[model samples]
Each structure stands twice: as C-alpha cells, then as structure tokens.
Target: MSRSFVKMNGLGNDFVVVEARGAPFRPTPEEVRAIADRESGIGCDQLIAIEPTANADAFMRIWNADGSEVSACGNATRCVGWLLMQAKGDGRATIETLAGLLTTWAAGPRAVTVDMGAPGLGWRDIPMAEDMDTRGVELQVGPIDAPHLHTPGCVSMGNPHVVFFVANAELAPVREVGPMIEHHLLFPEGVNVGFCEVREPDRIRLRVWERGAGETKACGTGACAAVVAASRRGLAKRRATVTLDGGDLKIDWREDDGHVLMSGPVAVEFTGVLP
Candidate 1:
C-alpha cells in the first residue's frame, strides 16, 4: 500500500511526516533509513509519524536519519503542532511522545511556541555513567593540562545533551569532537553535543551534533538545552536567543515554573506519496 506524506522543516531541520491517525503505520529501522536517504528517498533529518492518541491531539513518533527511534524531537513537535492547529483552526495543540506530553501554541504566522517542560539536571537524570556535577562534568578532549574542550554542562530535555561552552562556536571542531563525545562512556544512552558561544547575556550562537543524526541546520531541543546549560554556568541568562546555522530560536527558561519554552518557525516543504 502507498502512504501520503508531508515534508516539513523547522529552521532547516527537515522531516518527512506521515499521518497514521486512522490507520496503523509501522516501519522497521531499515525502512525508515531508506525513506530518509537523501539521494534515494524523500530525504530528511528525521521521520515523523502522527498517530492516534487518547490523551492528546496526536502522538508523534520520531526516527533519526539512521533509523533509530528516539523519544523526543523539538523541531518535529512544532511542525506537527502547526499542522494540527491549522486543521482544527485552533491556536493550541497538545502532543504526546515517549518523553512526555507537550503543549504548543501559535506564536505568529508559521511560528510556534512549545512548552518543552523542565530540564533534567541531576546526575541520574542525564543518566551519566557516574556521579558528578552536571554543571561541569569532568570530561576533557585533547591535552590533559589544556584540552581543546573540557567540562561541558549536561542536561536532558527529554533527551540527553551535553553543551560545551566555547570562545568561538564557528571555530569549534564539531565534526571531529562531536562524534567522540557523543559515544563517550559518560553518556550511557549516547548524547547530543552542542558547541555554544555566548555572544551576550541574552544571545548566543550554537551548533549541535545530534545522536544518530549528524549536524543539521537547527535543533530546537538543543537550543533549549544550550540556554539551560549556559544559565547553569552563569554564561547566559534564563532567556536568550540562540542562533544556529539555519536561523534563530528564542528560548526562555522560566524562573517561576522552570519549564523551558522554545519559540521558532515551521515550514512545509512539500507533500508526496510513499510507495
């Protein structure tokens, strides 16, 4: 059977979204990889399935380009949220994922704000291999005395992430160091790596190497995690603008509620049928 799909993107982090609310659509890891292949398939950073749910507007299942199913994806959430809201002619939508339930609302034309929930800061929360201060874990790359990168702040925004504060985000060896730290022993389930350069108290630049998916134009969850990690290290404020390769995102770590809010734009690239 053939399935209809939509191509969507949030800050260039693209997705091929399939709606299976009325029917069951289950694809194996290899199938997911084939569909996400740039040259042979539809091509996307992740594949999203909008499934039926009892408690929320929809259930979003995410798979990386490598075909690994993941618990959360911030960009995909915004894209799905926009689709739901547009269909219902409503301003808000709730989505369920393996990570948890998330609420999204229209911020503007094609823009959305998502309640990403509170970040996990404890050692066990990040699920590191050993106990240590999450603010600045004792990990280093390169030389022992003066490593190229050291002491990254770890946080889990539904998924594990480690942010390395750098003097210059553009100069960081993201491709070289990212893969090394992603599979490091400290992160038992692997981790998304972020290179962040604080430009100001309320603004910064970031780049992420997502686990199972290489570097992309943007990563919504990574942006939220970067702000949270920066705040923890006194590098940036609770609320800030994160500039990624694709575009910008406004992240607010509410002091009162402690929930991180991510605001960005979503776009529909096109639609197609899957054979």
Candidate 2:
C-alpha cells in the first residue's frame, strides 16, 4: 500500500513526515535507510511518524537518516507542531515523544515556538560512562600538554549532547573530530557534537554533527543545548540568538521555568506518496 508523506524543513534540516494516526507506520531499519537515501529515494535528515496519542495531540516517532530510532528532535518537533496547528486551525499544539511532552505555539507566519523541557545536567542524566562535571568534561583531542579541544559541556536535551567552545565555529574540526567524540567511551549512548562560537552575550554561532545524521544545516535541540552550555560556562547569557549554517534560532533557557524554548521557522518543501 502507498502512503502519503510530507517533506518539511526547519532551517534546512529536512524531514519526511508521515501521518500514521489512523494506521501504524513502522518501517524497518533497511527501509528507513532506503527512503532517506538522497540518490534514489525521498531524502531527509530524519523520518517522522505522527502517531495517535491519548495524552497529547500526537506522538512523534523519529528515526535518523542512518535508520537509528532516536528519542527527540527539536526541529522536527516545530515542523510537526505547525502541521497539527494548521490542521486544527489553532495556535497551540502538544506533542509527545520518548523525551517527554512538548508544548508548541505559533510564533508568527511559518514560525513556531517549542518548549523543549528542562535539560538534564547530572552525569547520570547524560548517562556518561563515569562521574564527571557536566559543565566541563575532561576530554582532550590533541597532545597531552596542549590539546586542541578540551573540556566540553555536556547536556541532555532529550538526547545527549556535548558543546565545545571554539574561537570560530567555521574553523572547528567538525568532520574530523565529531565522529570520534560521538562514539567515545565517555558517551556510551553516542552523542551529538556541537561547535559553538560566542559572538556576544546574547548571540552565538554554531555548527553541529548529529549522532546518526552527520552534519546538518541546523539542529534545534543543539541550539538550545549550546545556549545552556554557554550560560553554564559564563560565555553567554541564558537567552541568545543562535546562528546556524542555514539560519538563526532564538533559544531561551528560562530562569523561572527552567525549560528551554526554541523558536524557528518551518517550511514545507513538497508532498508525495511513498511506494
């Protein structure tokens, strides 16, 4: 049977969204890989299945291009929220995931704001291999005396992430070092690697190498995690405008609520039926 799918993106981080509310859409790892193949199939950074839910408006199941089923994706969340709001003709929508329940609201035309919940700061939360300060884990990438990248801040915004403060985001060795750190023993569950350059107290530049998707144009949760990491390191404020390769995102780690709010634009590229 053929199924309809929507191609959407948030700051160029694209997705293949399939509405599975009426029926379950469970694809095997091999099938997911085929659909995400850029050369032969409908390519996307992630594949999203919007399943029916009793608590929230819907349950979002996510799989990376590599066919790894993950817990959370902030950019995809905004895209899904927009779809639900557009369907209901409302301004707000709730989405449930393995990470937790997320509340989203229409910020403006083609833009949505998602409350990504509180970040996990404890070592156990990130589930590191051993006890270490999440503010700055003791890991180096260069020589023993003078390391190139050391002491990255770890945070779990539904998924494990490590943010390395750099002088220039563009110069950071993302492709060279990202894969090494992502599968490092410190992060037993694998981790998203972020290279963040703080331009101002309220502004920053970022680049991310996702765990299973390699480097993407933008990562919503990565942007949120970058702000939190910068704030904890005293390099940036609690709220900041994160400039990604594709575009900019407004990330606010609220002091009162302790929840991270990510705001960005969503776009629908095209729609088609999957064979």
Candidate 3:
C-alpha cells in the first residue's frame, strides 16, 4: 500500500515525513534505504514518522539515509514541530522521541525554537567503550608527531556526538576523517562528528558528519552539541550563534534550567505519496 508524506527541511537537512498516528507504518530497513536514495528514491537525509503520543503532541521516529533507526534528530524535530504547530494553529507544540520529550514554539512565520533539554556529559551516558573524560577524550588521528584531530569533546544530545575544535572548519578534512571516526571502536554504537571553528565568543562555524547520513548540509543536534562542548571548554559563551553549511542557528545553553534551546528556520519542500 502507498503512503502519503510531506517533504520539509530545517536548514538544508531535508526529510520525508510520514504520519501514521492512527495506523501502523513500519518500513523495513531496505525500504527506508530505497526511499532515501538520492538518485532513485524521494531523497532525503532522513525519514520521519509522526505517530500519536499519549504524553506529547506527537512521536517522531527517525531513520537515517542508511536506513539506521536513530534516537534523535534536531533538524527533523524543528521541521516536524513547525508542521505540528501549523496544523494545530497554535504557536507551541511538544514532540516525543526516543531521546525524550521536546517542547517547540514558533519563532516567526518560518522559524521555530525547540527546547532540546540538557545534554549528557558522562562517558557512560555517551556510552563510550571505556570510561574517560568527556571534555577531551584520548582519541586522536594522524601520526604521533602531529595528530590531525585529537582530544575531542564528547556530549550526548539524545544521541552521541564528538566535537572537534579546529582552527579552520574548511580545513578539517571532514570527508576523509569523518567515516573513520564514526566507525571507530571507541563509540561502539557509532557517533556523529562535528568539526567546529569558533570565530567569536558569540559566533561559530560548523560542519557535521552524521552517522548513517554522511555529510549533510546541516545538523541541528550537532550545533547544540557544539555550543555545549565549546562552552564547557571556555571557547564560546553559553549562548551563541552557530553557522552551518545551510544557514545559521541560535543556540542557548540556559544555565538556570539547564535546557539547550535551538532556534532556526524551517521550510516546506513539497508533499507527495510513497509509490
């Protein structure tokens, strides 16, 4: 049977969203891969399924391009949040995910702000293979004389992330080193990698190599992780603007509540049905 879907994007991280709140819509891993195929399928960084939740506005299920089911997706959350608010004709909405419950609100006509909640910093929370300091784990790349990337800060914004502070984001060798670190033994369940360049205390430049999605135009969770990591390292303020490949995001790590708020724009690409 065919299914209807909506295409949306938060920044340039796109998704094909299917609503199955009233009925079951389980797609096999192979099916998800086919739908995410850039050439033959609808093409998207991830596939989202919106299902009814007992405690929140809706439940969001995320599947990466590689057909891997993940716990969280910040960009996709914003997109789904905007859609839910629009449908309800309300400015606020809540979404439940494998990560947890997230609250969202309309920032503007096309913009949204999501409360991503507190980040997990413990090595066990990031579920690292061994216990280590998350602020600067003992992982490095390149020769002993000069490592290309080392001592990355790890954080779990629902999912696992490792942020590498680089002098220049453009020279971070994301394409070359991303896959290697993603599959490294340290992160037994794998991880998303972010190479960030702090331009100013209030501004940053970032690029992400998402697990299962390769390099995307943007990553919402990565941006949140970057800010949290940078703040912990005294590289940036608790609140700052993160500039990704697609656009900009305002991230605030609120001290009072310990919630990370992510504000950005969302766009509707189109709508369609599965064949």
Q: For each candidate, give its TM-score against the true structure.
A: 0.99, 0.99, 0.99
Error of 3 at 273 (Å): 0.6
List model 3 lDDT by residue over 1-275, tens digit each: 67899999998999999989878888999999999998999999999999998999999999999999999999899999999999999999999999999999999999999999999999998879999999999999999779988999999999999999999998889999999999999999999999999999999999999999999999999999999999999999999999999999999999998999999999998999997
Which regions of candidate 3 are displaced past 4 Å? none
TM-score of 3: 0.99
Q: Which segments of candidate 2 are over 4 A away from where they belong?
A: none
User: What TM-score, to 2 decimals, does candidate 1 have?
Assistant: 0.99
Listed per model in order, the count of residue pairs whose N, CA or C atoms clash below 3 Å is 0, 0, 0
- What is the per-residue lDDT of model 1 for residues 56-103, given as tens digits with 9 covering 90 to 100? 999999999998999999999999999999999999999999999999
RMSD of 2: 0.5
lDDT top scorer: 2
Q: What does candidate 2's lDDT look like per residue over 100-128, in tens digits? A: 99999999999999999999999999879
Model 3: number of clashes?
0
RMSD of 1: 0.6
